[model samples]
Target: MPHPPKELYTIADASERWGVTTDIIEDYLRSGKLQASVHLPRKMMHKYTRQPTECSFSDEVDVFDVDSCDPYSYMPQQGVFNLCYEDVNWDEAGKATLEKGGLYLSRPDDEEKCYYGFDEDFVLSRDKVYVSISELTRFEGEYGTTPRTEQQDCPEKVVKVSQDANPELHPKEKESLLKIVIAIAIGFYEFDPAKKKSPIANKITNLVYDLGLSIDVDTVRKWLKEAAEIVPRKKHKITPELLSDFGIPPHAKDD
Candidate 1:
């Protein structure tokens, strides 16, 4: 339950904060859009070799518990190790280096013997990179470069139509309605008669009426059954004419 370093965020943390994929964060680091630091455990030092016996340097060190998921030893005391780095490209081989804009202090030339540590069991880690929060001002406290999906785009049109039809609906209810309307437009719904005040419940009452559609579960079942009959026979692309057979007006679809 130790707190993560206040100044740094792991790739997963940055991904969530920026509303982007981990790969995007890594890309930002490579392009120099953000600065980063690598957390090198004492065990991961001396590449492909077993854990070392003692600290290489004489500085005061910080103790981080070994991640349970990591294959290294589970003993928390054994996980204690020092961190170090140098500025280098991620792809740099033969010598340990950062991916793009930071230093990797895990290993150094054997002759130089620049490793530093404290007296403790060697706790090596996966060599995860942490990004400084200060370097993230571009999209701080907001969603960043996550591209919108077609599903999101589709709901926007539905939301506009619903808002025009019912101006009094709360914004949150309208957002919920968009989801319900899209589900119905695509011919899918989990009709629950018992749940009365669900997101789609009252909001959809007016919408169903506005659309001149029946909300009865049995009626919807009949429509789905009929639609199923037509779908298999066509066995091809669904066009406006085919949609009309399912009671959808041709103009309802976006061009």
Candidate 2:
């Protein structure tokens, strides 16, 4: 089915764009770290089918009873559910709506496919409640990526420092940091790009924040190569691993 042209994204798109794993995204949803919305059935909106007039289904539901408590919106899709492992909208209009404190809902496309635009006018009523993780999202807060102009009284404080201006790291310090980066990047075990997407670059970026140092992923990778210059060399490392998740090549060969 065709989707609406509204400002909405799916879980996969959200993960790739936000630089976060779907697992982390799901965790945020489960914990309510991310605000989300679910899709309502069209049957609820129609008064004719409000009653359990059907005799086929084992479990018959009074449409009015369901609508009384949680009146899901039937805008996006008819009977199809609206959900995502992780999703978000960073468009200007989306931000504007959020700034004014309005939430957007993805409407069902004319073609019947998911991934359409958000409905700004439709707001959940006082009694509408989400029962499950219909769709995990980073629609608000940190993951929401609110712009500085729209930030709170005290906006996020951070001093930008370019790693290019910094002096080269000593071998030991570089190696230690590299080890930490690799450990975190590989999620322990061994470093392989083929099996999974290595977040090495992102990990290094995070470490720089933690250590208050100016370090780039290239610098860290260079340090790794420098550290690898040993008598017997370290041990097994990369071999046709899939670092493509990080936008690298599959079976990434040694540089």
Candidate 3:
């Protein structure tokens, strides 16, 4: 006879069954993606014992009962995986409503306030939400890329120098530079240009090449420097991996 499936699966079992890594399973449990019920023991006193000098005493206390409690019951219902808005305006409204300490309602303009309540069977759908064009434009203006109106005019002198500078340099270097120039014109220099000449640069250049663009190191560097000047600096401190890509040794001290 075939063996029956077990009632409870451990963390490893869940990971294998879901085709996800063990770390992912742990993350799901932590984020409450998967529901789990835990059985705790409830203590009970069996009987009473009597001693001549001490009078009555407790006898047996080994009895226990299974207490079922859902560990993920306390997870927030408004998490990213649980809730979604139809459009940017609705999303903004939802956020505003949440901030104002009100229940989320699908109809924002209805005369009769209708609210959607959370339930045990509630699950978030992965569909993309629709938003107003004006709201989308506003969102893009605030958080997305602005229109690139500036045209990159590579100086004839610089182009000539790049062409004549070094024949021995890798062909990938040239392609990398061109991409840097384009990125500079559009303003995207969050990384050091020298680092782009390294393996990481090679990878990015390859991606750009696949998109049908040629690149090189010098070209990439120039544009990267320009972009860096135009873009705001990030608040996070740079890591050693980032520094090392720019031909700088891992242990090198920063000036």
Candidate 4:
């Protein structure tokens, strides 16, 4: 039942508040890390379909015309193949009458007054969240709802998210990283501050400082502790799709 806000925010709104360019916010938005208030069109009057069972329809009487029992309805000699529950046979009514393949698929029920339409294909991603805030501006949400079969683009991004969620790490690499992270906390590759420091830990620490990435030891411990307690990850087969999520296209998925 969640609906888009009455007012939406724009890229400029986010940019001005953070004092950063829209490009930065754009990345966050695409990654789903930031909740962007984009204008998601709702073709409403709305309604997917389920194969029908039972004839408990409320008062449409006159029922099936005596000579017109649908064969598909399975009543000895009832409804024809593809005869819709409400006695509609798109084949007979013709596609143009129903506006077949229209952006929104609409249909009528018992009362005929309570008409309905399918939501815009891309509208499934809306889940409006609200926090105590001031102004609201417009957002440009997605409008593409083509099915995966119809879509001639990348497949679903099923690559597993990582503990660190590094955009740089190939998706499969997270399995290795998870092991290492947990290993550090559990003392398997012990980062002993008392005894000799782990060469691996030192190298990584040096790498962080060398890259000018500043973080506290407490934060490192916190992440390691969390990683250690996580449900152990199973070995993942590396694939081109996994590679693509990490921002490196290997062309393996081209086939």
Candidate 5:
């Protein structure tokens, strides 16, 4: 058997050698089908070296002969869905089981399932895949064992706001303020203290001052109360009176 070539080529070299355009190489990179490393220029080599050396190098150089999988290429005719595998239906579970080593999609069935797969391959339902980080954390709390990272712990400052000794706002306002505090604590956004010229802004400024946050209370309050709504609480434990009110007959509780 003849020995394979040991010399590695830059993307430019490979492009010239293969008679392909640089765009093709870039496509391969974006698709994650190819791996490349960058090469830096050395002053000594640029000034002192006499013999013609390969000058053009890529910030990203491709590494050949490694096993690479393109999620798009093997993706079923579905979309990319992020979900816990355990939640999928039996048929989908079977398909995922088959593609356990690599990315794969579940087979479609009558039951509801989240559609997800790389590129065209999908799990086969209009189910939403991506979720906000906060939701993922909540899921972790409910499931006990989360497949993803939990929401980061709140800072002491926010904790203090939640435990305000003298809350100078309504329940809804306080709730909004708490959310804003959390947003600020998580470094998502900041309140501008100088922009508190409106009545709503003034209210927020008062709340911020009360909470000991040196932020423009008005701005913070505006963001906190903006689009705020009360979420309806869920009823899990039903009383006998509630059941009777629903017309389920008194004997049904015993059964």
Candidate 6:
């Protein structure tokens, strides 16, 4: 049997279509470079019956049948639900949806076999998420590149820094600041020719603000692009594990 054309793609589907890892798609979503929507099947959205808190009759006349009151009569058609492990059985629903070639969200950090570690950061609700297939296709056309994991090591390029760019700072101070900025760009944003520099610039600007520094974003962006030109493309492959070797401690924060 043939299935209908898909109008939306799940994170997993987009990962497969783009030849990238799911982490990459998630990063794009987290960075606000992509959009998605939460969806639940109409069948699953049906309101569940609930217990009554009190009898409808007066306290002195509480001899009427409790079954007379409709459980959902006073309840809103839509409301919140507890999808926690102890409250709901999500594995059965997730499995059923997948078996039918349908996409469904799995429990986050579930101790059971269905755990996929999906979290509230991705979607507030336990419902599955979907991205417009056309929008994702357009994104891929603009930003798709060779997966970082499969990229071969390349020689570093050398770019001369303009000494007069920031004459107010000493050469030594500039060098030190550039090193810190480059380290953050490489370690956190995987700065490289294939990646966009705007997000990296914005992140560095925020960090500088947190540190009470006054550098403007345009300057930070200029410095990053210039410094990134000389960084070895291979260095973009550095993983979080290797960051410790560079003296970046685990879970280190400004506060």
> Highest lDDT, which number?
6
lDDT of each: 0.46, 0.41, 0.38, 0.37, 0.37, 0.50
For candidate 3, lDDT tens digit of each residue in 116-231? Answer: 23332222221222222333234346644332221123366577688788456475775565444434323222344333343434455676789998888555445555444433
Off by over 4 Å in 2: 1-6, 38-255
lDDT (10s digit) by residue, model 6, range 1-255:
998658767778777766778777767765656655444332222122223346665454422121325463222222111122222223434521222211223322335322111211222332344566655766756776543333332222111133344347777787777667667666666555447745777777888899988789999888987666555666555655545644565444222
lDDT, residue 171, model 5 = 72
Model 5 poorest ten-residue lDDT run: 41-50
**lDDT tens digits, residues 1-255, model 1?**
998547667768877765668878767666656655544433322222223335755245533332335453221122222234223333333233233212233232245233332233332232356766555654443434432353466689899998899789686775555444433533323323233223444345556778997576544444444333334444224465644655656665553
Query: Local error of candidate 5 at 107, Å?
Result: 5.8
The alpha-carbon lDDT assigned to residue 136 of candidate 6 equals 73
Ranking by TM-score: 6, 1, 2, 4, 3, 5
RMSD (Cα, Å) of candidate 1? Answer: 20.9
**Per-model C-alpha RMSD:** 20.9, 23.1, 26.9, 24.7, 28.4, 24.1
- Provide the lDDT at 218 for model 5: 45
2 against 5, candidate with superior lDDT: 2
Task: Provide the lDDT at 85 for model 4.
Answer: 19
- Return the lDDT, model 4, position 93: 28
lDDT of 2 by residue, 23-71 (tens): 5654655565654445454422311113445656636543322223334
TM-score-superior candidate, 1 or 2: 1
